[model samples]
Target: MDPSIVREIHQIVPENRVFLDLQERYSYSYDASFGEYLPDIVIQPQSALEISKLVKLANQHRIPVYPRGSATSLSGGSLPVHGGMVLDMSQLKQKCIIDRENLLAIVSPGVTTAEIHRKAEEAGLFYPPDPSSSHISTIGGNLLENSSGPKGLKYGTTKEYVIGLEVVTPTGEIVRTGGKTVKNVTGYDLTRLIVGSEGTLAIVTEAILRLIPKPPARKTMYATFAEFVTSGVAITNILSQGILPAAMEMLDQQCIRAVENFKPIGLPTDAEAMVIIEVDGHPLAVDEEIERCAQVCKEAGATSVHIARDEQERDKIWQARKNVSPALAQVGPTKISEDATVPRNQIPAMMNRLREIREKYQLNLFVFGHAGDGNLHPTIITDKQNKEEMKRVEDAVSEIFEAAISLGGTLSGEHGIGIMKSPYMEMELGEEGLRLMKLIKDAWDPNHILNPGKIFPQPGQTKVVLTDE
Candidate 1:
């Protein structure tokens, strides 16, 4: 709120992009996390140069700046902590260079993941990482979170597809890492490090993403199980059989019924769990794999298996999965979704223990996620305004994190340990492990102004030495 800082903001970005109006600033106060923190100012920079200038001014004054793209994150990663300024990246949307020969594309941070997919399809190439929030989440936010979607099991996550980056570090120094070319390891893989820093390391300006040829054929299969464990067993059996599916997802009966309310997609209503598997390749190859997967599903004790006959049916199947998030959300005004991932083989045990917790806490919880990779999104729906209920939800979430670690799993699979998971990070990684993290963070961001109060806990609260002796 300083006069000089206000002047610098206007000087950097155009007057039209800067909003000092209280009502407008109030609108940028929260994200999809159901959390709120009103920022004092909101800046929508039109270009990378403008962004750098604003960052410089914010850092100089030690004002907290939260970088947000679409603000569709599940965790409160984009929520402003100290309430200074929010750098809205949505206005910086731009996509160019659909280089088919190089199999890559250059895009601004504000570009949505789905936008890139549509553009890439026009160029006959494919950019594969498809987070469930692809329609609303921005490319920069996806990079910061290292988001993974259904196809992540086969194509890999954001870290694998990001070839290079043009990022502005916390000090407002714009630095470029990597290039359009793929497969380069001349030194430390800093590009990968920045990929999932959740905006704490830097503000990604633009990105160069790796693209592969679009698959010629894809077949989808849905199987219902009498028991949830059997569904999980099917996932492990398929992978153990050396059949890499493009996507293998699972949803318990509660999740299925939620989706069935508004639009019935022929999903088994009485089934304990359901598994949706997709295989893609050449026509002959895809067909053979689909048949092989069907056999594996049966061996794992599936009650019935249904394979989509055409593209229309395929879309319908995915539609159900896409709506699964919103469907489970209806249980309460606020949905608390956590990403607890165990190894593929341990998925059955994880799912069983989750059910036990739900019964113990008397929670009406619904569980679903990418079963192929053992990442589950156990959603706890509750009215955030209900203080008593909220406390119970918090305890359940803490226990869930501890349970995941006890199963030899980590706290998060895709969603980073933002403000929501930072407190519980020690449960998974002890003080010694966290110490090493802080050392690296301090080396890059000495001021701790960029997306401060994220990833790790506050200073003095952590045993991690910020200095290199």
Candidate 2:
């Protein structure tokens, strides 16, 4: 970058907020996902006005501008792949207002999802899009990825709660989409378009999120099955019986053993699979629903069923589920986590296909995810240092995507089509369909100055390239 450009940026934002040193720039290079491309400059804009000015400058210079939040993106959503300038949105945390009168929470993009949940609960309201990384991820990133966790089966993803947004367009124009009302069909639904766009379309500065009354009571239960197929059957039985759980999570034997070894959670390591189910509603309703869920599990061939006697027991069950990622980290240096989701009925078939891929590749692939919603996370634990094993891992990942699409599923459920999945977009969306999406991108960003080298694949790119060398 030219010294004149840096001086102009300093004029737009404070000199203290502009970071041009190589060390400071390196911190913005990578995200939670693998790969690293250091941005030429890192700017912490504290207001939408600052962002608008910075964006205008970027557009004038044709510099790629990557908007980033807390950097907790699992799909490389916030990685500075093109590496021109990184707009650190985390420093824009100024607003988080819970409008109890309208059942809405107006928040800045930098507010953590967990903080919104806490404030909403304090006000007798609920924001239900709880991704696993909510404790650390920003609301901006969550909206961009449209990420949801176990509760997606019942409450839907982040897009469902977002009613309005204040965004800076790719060309540096500030625009507001939607409004506070839930029934706004005024114009093009740009709000939904921008959300889940993975920051390619625009940068979200603020959002108005819809909230519902918190559930009065909730019940949790844990079940272990001798076979994964039996666990899948139990999930189908529970939902088939008209019992909609708040969350239904499944963990395979490998994950169970990993968690047990990590923290001694007392899980049944011998079991082929374990499931945790939770129902939330009126106290009396939840009590009856939990019992019905337990009976359904037993009928589906569960070897053991444990209903939580209290909140501590409930936390114990959930804690084990939460420990999965950390436990798996202990197994290998590299973890390639893929969220391939299918229709609820096809989960069993997908699970079987995943087992086949695991065995065929001879890799340590573990399976777990939200069973009720058919979003299974098939994670491969391996060392990227081993070129031979990484080649197999790459093939296994391709097969996994093919298996999910073949089973009438998607390549990703919550994780957006970041750089990792961009190469496979054509496989999922036909050529014409992909072309239409590109048209939208071209119309919105003519210069291709915002978040370049993401979502849309480069020429001749067809598969994931995992070897860093």
Candidate 3:
């Protein structure tokens, strides 16, 4: 970058806030994705006005700006492949309640998801979206990508929880959409449009999210299955029996072992698969639901089941589930998590194909996710240095995606199709859909200044812009 631009940014913001050193820039280069590429500059803005000035400056210089939250992303969504400025938003972390009686919390984009949940808890309210990365991921990025979690089974995804948005347009124009009211049938629904734009449309500055009353009491259970298919079947049976557990997660043999190895949480290592189910409601209602769920699991071929005798046992049951990603990371440095979701009843078929893919690729795999929602994160751990082995893993990923599409599923359940899945996007959405996406991208960013080289591909391109230009 020219020294003039750096000087201008310093004039607009501050020297200490704008990071240009190679070492600091290197740290900001990558997210949770396997790929890494440093940005030309990383600027931390403390206010929307600071960001407004920075965005306009970057646009005037024809610099691609990558707006990042907590950088806990898996799809390289936060990677600045264009070598332009990365507008780090973690500094814009201020949060305050706009109106509590109206159940609205006004928060800056950089606030962690976990903080929002804790705030809601204090107010006798609840925020349904709880991504596993809630402790690290920001509310801004969650709204940007429309992230989901186990709560999605009952409360829907982030987009559903978002009622309004405050966005900084590519040209530095600030705008607001939706409002405090629930049934605002307002114009355009841009709030919904930008909810999952993945930082390509605009940078979210603040959000007005909806909150529900937290459940009274919760009970968690562990259902052990001799067969993976049986666990999937048990999930289907429980949902069909009208026993809506607070959360229903399934872990295959590989996931269980990986978690146990990482954190010895006293789980049955011999079980082929384990299903962690939870119910939260009135004491009497929960007891009845638990009994029904247990019966359904038994009928669906569970080898054994354990209902928590107390809250202590309950925490132990969930500890294994919580340790999944870190545990899988212990196996290899590069952990690629795929979010392919099929229909509720097709989970058995999906799990079966997953095992087949793991065997065919001959790689370390961990499969676990919200079984109630049919969203499974089949993680593949590998050493990227081995080109030939990675080729096999790529083939296996392609096969798994094909199976998902064949079974009426999309490529991503929560994680957006950033650069990671851009190559095979046409296989799923085809030429016409790709053109429509391009048209939308062009409408939003006529100059292609917004986060470019994502979602869609230009023909004959080697990659989805893997390096800083």
Task: Name the top TM-score candidate.
Answer: 2
Query: What does candidate 1's lDDT look like per residue over 264-362, in tens digits?
Result: 877888999988999998999999999999999999899999899999988988888888887876667878888999988888888888888898788
Poorly placed runs, candidate 2 (over 4 Å): none
Model 1, residue 222: displacement in angstroms? 0.2
Q: State each model's CA lDDT, in order.
A: 0.85, 0.93, 0.85
Best by lDDT: 2
Q: How close is every model to the real structure, measured as TM-score? A: 0.96, 0.99, 0.96
Model 2 residue pairs with clashes: none
Residue 253's lDDT within candidate 3 is: 89
Q: Which pairs of residues have clashing backbones in candidate 1? A: none
Ranking by lDDT: 2, 1, 3
Q: Single out the weakest 10-residue window by summed lDDT for candidate 3.
A: 460-469
Clashes of 1: 0
lDDT of 2 by residue, 283-360 (tens): 999999999999999999999999999999999999999999999999999888899999988988998899999999
Q: What ranges in model 1 sit over 4 Å off?
A: 459-469
What TM-score does candidate 2 reach? 0.99
